[model samples]
Target: MTAPAAPEVLRHVDALAEVVGRQHVLVGEQVPARHVQDLWGSDRKGVASVVVCPGTPAEVARVLRLCAEHRQPVVVQGGMTGLVSGGVPGPEEVVLSTERLDSIGEIDPAIATVTAGAGVTLADLQDEAARHGLVVPIDLASKGSATIGGCVATNAGGVNVVGYGMTRQHVRSLQVALADGRLLELSTPLVKDNAGFDLKQLFIGSEGTLGVVTAATLALRQAPRTRTGVFCAVADVAGALELLTAIRAQLPGMLTAFEVVWADAYAVLDGLDLRLPLPMGYPVYVLAEVQGGRPEADSEALLACLASIEHVLLDSAVADTAAELAVFWQARERIPSEILRMQPLFGFDVSVSARDLQDCLERMRAELTERWPQVKLLVFGHLGDDNVHIAVVTGEQTRKRKAEVEHIVYGCVSRSSGSISAEHGIGFEKRPYLGYTRSPEEMELMRSLKALLDPAGILNRGRVLTWGNETDPA
Candidate 1:
């Protein structure tokens, strides 16, 4: 049971209530478990003195001002669908949730843009854009629950990243509440604005440490007339890369997705009792997709491209209809959840150049298996963009040996000159390993910016960078 808020905490809550309203301020038991824990069901949870739901950018600024005055740390949360513990609040901290800012403005078809509150889900924004015969190019498996604010905050990259780019490319402008309670508006709808520095980029992937995103004006693309998806059983990782190169050369910009699933990951589908779209014996599986104006011609072109690389493929399945496409994609999306179900699962998202990806994985697997012979490593991801998701599990107490596993994984990444985090921001979970990717000079520059934007270090205090370190510029 949660203890009652102390008198001082209640006073702080009352001050916060003045900004959002008493009903929107939640304390103690009123705060739901979902607000404090990671949505992926990680054991790392946190405690918030209060959870405030602000309905507007103005309200958000006011709440931040109050928290800033009280020297109270504030954590910003959106859909809570992040795999990292970025949104999880800390003890005695205040949680400023964007849930109530769920408003969508008129879709400007002429400018190919739409303004939406940070609380708006990606799926809702996509639907609204679709109604206008347009689309938000950023796509993710958690679209139904992931909010626009969170996506912008993390600069989320999904399957479409190969063609359309990441969330940073889609974001036109951002309305953010700074740590000092100031509202910074950068809502310019122009396609090219070079008048000054692009300041909105600062908060795009800051993960709420710099400020709280209240709303965004996002760029959209015209809806394609048709989308074709294909699932292929590749001979190996090399063949998968070869096939991807051919598809990109043949289909060009039409190729939106090139996801690769290792045989070990594909086998997990069978364990979950899910129907396998393709046989599980192949060394690697690829889910390729293309969207174009001409349905028939585009489908034929895609099929022809796959046929041209017949020697690299063992077998293939094409999705002629939308229903079949969804079924084919379902197998790829189900890997994360199925792997999470395993006890003491250690999940990692890392990136390397396409040339070194196979070798990096091979070395990491060898090292991990040498330490623990029974370890299972399931790997898959957006091979088109040089990113991969690795899930590891051993029959023993794997959680206790997490550090050892991370060392093996990140060491290989460091040796390969790769990033410790690919799409996921360095939340507290990956905070310690950030050095594996960033240099001392780069880290110092990051701290300087953090101190400049949030001098008090009250916004996401112990996140990406440690709080109150000896080298802290603040």
Candidate 2:
């Protein structure tokens, strides 16, 4: 592979600027520091030579075409709030940002769907849906900054995933730009379509390696009239699972979320300036929510259910008012940012079957403690979905320590037949651990797909799955 000359680089940048307007393109120092870094880790201060903000899919296609012609690698960025280093650009690469393609298009009530631009934030989409008495059920802590395209690309699963499912379930179809700059309108927001194949599913969680998702037709749910929350403490993982089963059986569609935060995680949240419903000291705590009509009655019903299981719960509190409900969720949503407050922290999100989750956690904790005597592990997440978030706070944040911790955690996950990544895609950070989750045949198939969709390997060049010596398959 011959490297592009200085003249070729200049020609590509000039062409990109012309396609997306000079004001929308940034190079070198012009790129903001925030754009240089993702949700975590050190910023790539001067890695990329150019950042292009295309307002429309047509402009995005043209930009990709130009980049392909110049043999210049392009990294696609949405909200820049990704946990993995998937969106981070290399020194020679160009960044294609979807911040300008943020338009909330048609919201068809009849079809129970909404058409939104890739750049539209999750919060914005929720607000729009609220006005029409509909909902884009997928949610996350970074909803304020996380774009629809990023969520769909990563197949994000949030607190409500136990009920509404992940971004993949909510997304009906997608409009994508292929490697050669050709556009493809995959499908529509139709409920029943016995088409030959659902091609849009490939891009939903492919992490931009397959194509650039410019717009999406997402399935919407009816906005529930009432949303009640309950913050309670359970005896152990068994009690937590029992509570989940009971709540699901009783509430049915009403139970929208079931989140579990371990004692260590509660200790972190206890320091925050918020009211703790239950006195903060429990083996495990759950933030359960129900969505239906009659908020007051729903709260009472949830309270009654808790009372019936008083034998299993150590202590509990119910939120009948909206303010109280907000406080309960506030504690859960604050986990990600507050965990960062603990210096030398490493966070992970993995999944295991409910039956094996407890053993997996115990093995992980015991092994981690034996390895790092002074380490602190804060565990929490949507337990109803069998997904848990672990934050490892250790005295040493060295590269070697981090790698060892990863090995221990992912090793346990592999032993339990659990996924290394529950919702977050295996970006470059988790690429090494992919083998623990998937078989060799799976990796080869992924490579084949990458080669077929992005033959030049110019799009997100080294993300999700890296190629040989930065040029071929690893």
What is the C-alpha local distance difference test score of each model? 0.87, 0.83
Best by TM-score: 1
TM-score, model 1 to reference: 0.97
Candidate 1: list runs displaced more than 4 Å: 3-8, 271-273, 469-474
What TM-score quantifies how close candidate 2 is to the native fold? Answer: 0.95
The sequence of per-residue lDDT tens digits that candidate 1 reaches over residues 281-352 is: 888899998999997899999889988998888999999999899888888999888888787888889999
Clashing residue pairs for model 1: none
Q: Model 1, residue 111: what's the lDDT? A: 88
Candidate 2, 217-261: lDDT as tens digits: 898988888888788898799999989988887777788899999
Give, for candidate 1, the lowest lDDT window spanning 10 residues.
Answer: 465-474
Q: Model 2, stretches more than 4 Å misplaced?
A: 1-10, 42-46, 294-297, 470-474
